[model samples]
Target: MTGRFITLEGGDGAGKTTQAALLTDWLEASGRTVVRTREPGGTDLGQRIREMVLHERGHVAPRAEALLYAADRAHHVETVVRPALERGEVVLQDRYIDSSVAYQGVARGLGADRIRSVSEWAADGLAPDLTVLLDLDVTVGRARVAAARGDTFDRLESEAAAFHETVRGAFLDAAAAEPARFLVVDASAPAEDVQRAVRTAVGALVGIPAPDPSAS
Candidate 1:
């Protein structure tokens, strides 16, 4: 039997990565082999693509940037993610296709259908079993991102709250369309509360009992 794929997603500063780590550790303690990875960095090629997507190297056209993200995701799935999943190892991803759909497709003014087509080609149709979306007010998200020590602002970071409204709406739309696969998390709460929600969501997805310890 193949393992389940669970992904964390949201606008910048939604704390998806931090939540992903907590979930990974919790799931690992349950004796399930867990593989934690992220888009645009899971494979060597993907890492290069990540730099390109983040505009760390050169200026990338918006459409080209979207395609590059798709390309990196393709390699990531084919090389690192799927194999572990086939071995029944729980796969925890920091971000997934919806990030592109929201950031590029909606916020960048590209159509979601076009983005989906490109992404589907890239991922070979391997969608995650569950997606956790950390929802927060755009202003709040930007503020949190700015306060983080290791966080690097991306191209999408400069956009004002209005742009983020589109992205957030897109995320909510995706979640509404696939209620069984997407969980909207209110990220404005304390960090531990958000992590608790993630743990519960993941536990429900894989039929594994979550650790009962109170969030620290």
Candidate 2:
């Protein structure tokens, strides 16, 4: 049986990492083999590319940035994601094509369709079975990131508030366009509340019975 693919997407500090870890832990507790990974760093080559795109102190052209992301996604999906899924393990990824579509396409003015085409071709059309989108106000998200990382910002994180707002809008647009594949959750809630919502959403996908609050 082919395993399910789940991707977590959101702006910086929207709690994607926390949610991914929580989901992975819950899924493992349920006896499912889970392959947790992230794009732009999922593979050896991708790690270098991730550094270039995210932390390198230089101006990379918008198109070049898009292509670098596509390259990483291509290698990551081919080597890491596909093989794990083929082995019947759930592949939980931190980011996927939607990140590129929003970050490069809308925020960087690279055109969403163009970036999507490049990313689709690179990943060989491997779309996630489910995408959990953590929606939060850009200002709130930025504040969270700032509070967590004192005076440190990656390339994408350092962008102006307007840039992040565009990225947030793009994510919501994508979710709205594909309601079946996306579960949009308000991320401003407390971490415990977000985790509960995540568990409930993912429980349906893996056929896990909902938690019995009274039993616990």
Which candidate number would show the highest lDDT if scored against the true structure? Answer: 2
Q: What is the C-alpha RMSD of each candidate to the true structure, in Å?
A: 1.9, 1.4
What is the TM-score (0 to 1) of candidate 2?
Answer: 0.96
lDDT of 2 by residue, 61-90 (tens): 999999999999999998999898899899
Residues 1-216 of candidate 1: C-alpha lDDT, one tens digit per residue = 379998888887888878888877888877778898998688889888877777574567889989889889888998888899899899999888998899888888888989988998888988989999889888888888888844567766766788888888899899999999998989999888888778877887777776466745
How high is each candidate's TM-score? 0.92, 0.96
Model 2: CA > 4 A from native: 213-216
Model 2 Cα shift for residue 50 (angstroms):
0.6
Candidate 1 local Cα displacement, residue 143, angstroms: 0.9
For candidate 2, the 10 contiguous residues with the lowest summed lDDT are 207-216
Off by over 4 Å in 1: 150-152, 210-216
